[model samples]
Target: AVALGVKFLDAQRKELPQGGAALADLVTLDMSGLDPRLGTVKIEVACDVQNLLCGPEGASAVYGPQKGANLEDISIMDSALNNFGEVLSRVANTNLLELVGGGAAGGLGAGLVGFLGAELRPGTQMILDITGADEKIKQADLVITGEGRTDFQTAYGKVPVGVAALAQKYSVPVLCISGDVEGSPDFLADLGVATCFSVAEGPTTLEEAFLKADEQLERAAWRILTVWKLAEECQLKKLRHS
Candidate 1:
């Protein structure tokens, strides 16, 4: 099965699927057999999201705004997704809407699952396992992870949280330093993020933040390192006195 969402559902309405059309119906799949050039292949869709299909947290409602989809467009897209989910459920003989990571990359997760019977994998852990990150995290004194933005959503299968899961196994503290930080501090802590902060030092416009990204990152890094050094020294002094 081919991936959808990232390409098919763009700002420009290229070819909107008709009402109640399964995503598979919109595309033609070659089920005759695997291509002769490639031998048996196992399909796996790795994504760092857990949003279900057809809901507020679904792809259209959550990611549409970033893709230049306005209210009218989001509403339309959501309705189309609901209809598509219903049809795919019958064809796949499975509940695509309830599939974890189904909303990923704009229904790409659902597409792969429905059409190809591909496995939905948690991308971060999968990649980290491949990259031997567990060994590196085990040896490191601290683990630093970040994303474009950290908010309530970050708690839901985001990159930083994925890193935190591995680091926590080795009793390593995880610090998240994102371009932007939102949601409550408690919520962030609950996600196993020791601490998190935005790169911006003060109020700044989106354009300004983008332009000053490098400088802002440097300043934030400096601040975090300085505080860390002080904490280390304090610990040393306390040990000496005790």
Candidate 2:
């Protein structure tokens, strides 16, 4: 009877049974007030896992190195991921070592696929589907989307790109706002983004910017609305004259 139960459990693991259940935990370290390079590397690794596995690598890299890992430590973690990828190929008969988004989360992506059978899909697509953003675009007067930063990466399946595409299908103008603008803003025009704005007034340190993010966003919002109001007034005046 015990042997039968054990066999049943193995079968369940091999094939997702009715009422599928996920048994796992994702751990991330709290890395704050530490070396920024290490922190960023850790975050990049975790993001890789999240993109490849279930949801994005939410916890690990985002929080890790802040807890005290240095560049050397990050490299060690990266190596671990490479080795894990090799192991995954042997066990799963799928080589995720070279997969895009595979290097996320210190190789957490490899770990997820190798150990938990997760698959990688574009994060933007997932968000669009989940939010019914396509339908929303059809109804909206204007589409507004934003991020902490806008750069070349924004073109790579980021929220703004996804939202802009949906807005374009409805022939609606899409606007983007970001805490900082990097690279060329004109580049995003091709993505159905009509315009982009950076919140910063001028040069400021990272600490000052973060502290002022909410206030800056509020001010930007007011400015945008004010411009829209002026445009509306001009249109109304023209109609009256005509």
Candidate number of the best TM-score: 1
Query: Can you write out model 2's per-residue Cα lDDT over 1-242, one digit (the tens) per residue?
Result: 11112111222235212211211111121113333443233221222122332212322233235457665554444444444455446655787765656645444565545444566565666778787888878998777789988876576557788788778888999888899988778999998997789999889999999999999998888888788889889999999999
**Cα RMSD (angstroms) for every candidate in the order listed:** 5.4, 12.9
Backbone clashes, candidate 2: 15
What are the TM-scores, per candidate, against the unseen true structure?
0.79, 0.60
Q: Write the per-residue lDDT of candidate 1 for residues 82-107, one digit (tens) a residue.
A: 66676666667899989999998888
Q: How far off is residue 151 in model 2, in Å?
A: 1.8
Best by lDDT: 1
In candidate 1 the C-alpha lDDT for residue 141 amounts to: 80
Q: Which stretches of candidate 2 lie over 4 Å from their true place?
A: 1-87, 232-242
Could you tell me the TM-score of candidate 2?
0.60
| Model 1 C-alpha lDDT versus the unseen true structure | 0.77
For residue 157, model 2's alpha carbon misses the true position, in angstroms, by 1.6
